[model samples]
Structures are given as C-alpha cells and as structure tokens.
Target: MYVGGGAGNVGGAAVTLASRAGARVVATARPEDAAEVRHLGAAEVLDYRSPDLGEQLRRAAPGGYHVHLDTSGRGLLADAVDLLAPGGRLVAMTGLGRGAAELPLGRLYTRDASIVGFALSNAATADLAEAAEGAVGALGDTPWRPRIADRLPLSRTAEAHRRMDAGGVRGRLVLTVGAADGR
Candidate 1:
C-alpha cells in the first residue's frame, strides 16, 4: 500500500494506522519530514517531489500497490493508476482541484482500478465509531497521539485557513473554540 502526504497530519495518521494494520506502507513526504514519516511506520519513505517518482514507486513495490491513499492530492492519480495492482483502490482525499486532472482510463479500466474521494466528516457516526474501535485495536498496548503542528484561537480561524491554503503548515492545525482562558 502507498500513503501520499506521509508527513502531514492526516498522512502521518494514515501511515501509523496502516502500519498498525500490518500493511507494508510505502509513503511519500517532503525531504525534511522523511524521518518523522518513517518513524510513524512507513517501511519506505520517498521524496514526493522526486524527479523519478514513478520509478521510485515502482522500485519500492514492483508488483504495484493494492491501495493508494493520497492525502496531499498532488495530482498523482495518473501515476498511481499506472502502478495499481489488479482491483486496486485509490482514495484521494485532498487536492480535488477545480481544473480537470487527466487519468489513464484505458489502464485504469483494464486493471479494474477505481478512484474515490471522501471527507471524513461526511462519514456516518456508526462508521466513525467502528473505525475508531479498529484503530484502538490495531494499536494494541501502544499509545497514540495526533500530530499537531499549530494551535490558534478561534479568532484566527481565517488565518488558519490561509495557512492551510498555503500548504506549508505540517500536521493538524488545532483551533481553540475560544481564548486559552475560559471566556
């Protein structure tokens, strides 16, 4: 399996969860974040921006990935589709850009590959609970903590969004509902 955006908040969590699930995770991260992504449990961490990303991905798992989770959404669908094993699934969560992104339909269809994009908040509560339970089960006795990159008060909500838009902030950007002190 492959996890894109392996260093970001959601990606980091995905790596950890996927690892705990006994999957051999090959993930991509920025050069600086490679260590943390590896620490989170990716068997191999590659630079997402590498010139030969396709080659690297192929070399990492020549048989191809059964599942590709794209948290960063860097327009890797075509490349991912090329590397999908039979009946592979691509879960693209972010970077659903306004402009059209081309995909290799012939290849995708021939391999019986499918692509899906979803928002976690849109998931049913029952499903969420089930996933949470599974995450806990996967952890065994290990403790888990979300990777938080920044914390801002509610008053700066717009600023937080801007930071997210800029795509430089790493991990989860936590926003307090109010001031640090009760207000």
Candidate 2:
C-alpha cells in the first residue's frame, strides 16, 4: 500500500515497483488522482479524503497489506500499523511539516510489525550509485517511467519551487540546465 499517490515521486515509484514485483498494489490519493494512480499500476486506489477511508481500505485488502510505504508521512503510521499484516513493514520516506506523531506501540509489538524511516541523504555514495545503475537498467526492460509534469528553464527555478509548494503538481518539476541541444 502506498500513501500520497498524488505526489507521484516516491509514491508513483512504489506503486510501479510493488506491482512489478507481483504484489497487489493499493494506493491513496485525492479523487482526481485515482485514474493516474491506477495507470501507475495500483490494483486499488482509495480517496484519502473520504470519511470512510479506513473501512474502504479494509474492504479493498481484506488480508491486510504486507507492506506500506508512506510518502506524505502526515501521521499515518498508526493507521498503517492497524492495516498491516503480521510481520508487515512500513517505511516512511517523508514527513514535511508534520511533527511527533503517535505510534501504537502495543499494536505494533502485538502484530509483530515494524516501522522504518528512510532518507536518501543518509545513504552511502556507493550504494546510491549502485541503485541508480539498477534503476537505469530496469527502465530498459520495464514499462515504468517517471512522470514529468513540467520542464522549466533554470532561470525559472523559483517559479518551479513555488508551484511545487502550492501543491497539486503531479510527478516531477524538472529544471533544465544549459541548452536543449546538449550544448
């Protein structure tokens, strides 16, 4: 299960990777992003804004999600724990403005589940290079591709940041350097 499907950066990659690995992928996003999430290989897309989101998720994956990737990190760890299968793992990649969310220690221990935090910044350079190489190799044989919402010139970097900060920017906002002709 992937949280923040609308972001389309980490969440989109999670959907593609999980599906490619033969997992039944489920994602959460705004209603407008449902179709896109499905296109990214989600077997089920739940509207995160719905009041009955928990119930809907339960219905969608009755066996419980074996893995949960939380990209928004907006205090969803507790809920994800409740929806996890025994010995399931939840990885959180981002938290932005959120602070100090409560974790259900009792449930986590009882279910034998685990929550892990990840940050690329802390990765070793060699590991990063290896992962990058693997990603490039995989791209050659897979239908998975990064979605680019907009490509802006380097001069418009501030504008790009503003657009991202305003939310609703799907995929990535690319900043083009130098000339388009590879000069």
Give lDDT per model, in order: 0.83, 0.78
Q: How does each model score on TM-score?
A: 0.83, 0.86
Give the residue spans of candidate 2 off by over 4 A: 1-7, 179-183
Clashing pairs in 2: none
Which pairs clash in the backbone of model 1?
Answer: none
Clashes of each: 0, 0
lDDT per residue as tens, model 1, 1-183: 899888876777788888877999999988887888888889999998899988999999988899999887784668789989889998877765646777889999999989887888898999999988976676545433667888888777899999999976757889887556255
Candidate 2 lDDT by residue in tens digits, 1-183: 545553366777777777778888878887787887787778888888788988988898887778888775553778888998888887877775677777899999898988888889999999999998987775546556787999988888899999989987867898888786254
- Look at candidate 2 and tell me the lDDT of residue 150: 92
14: Cα error in model 1, Å: 1.7
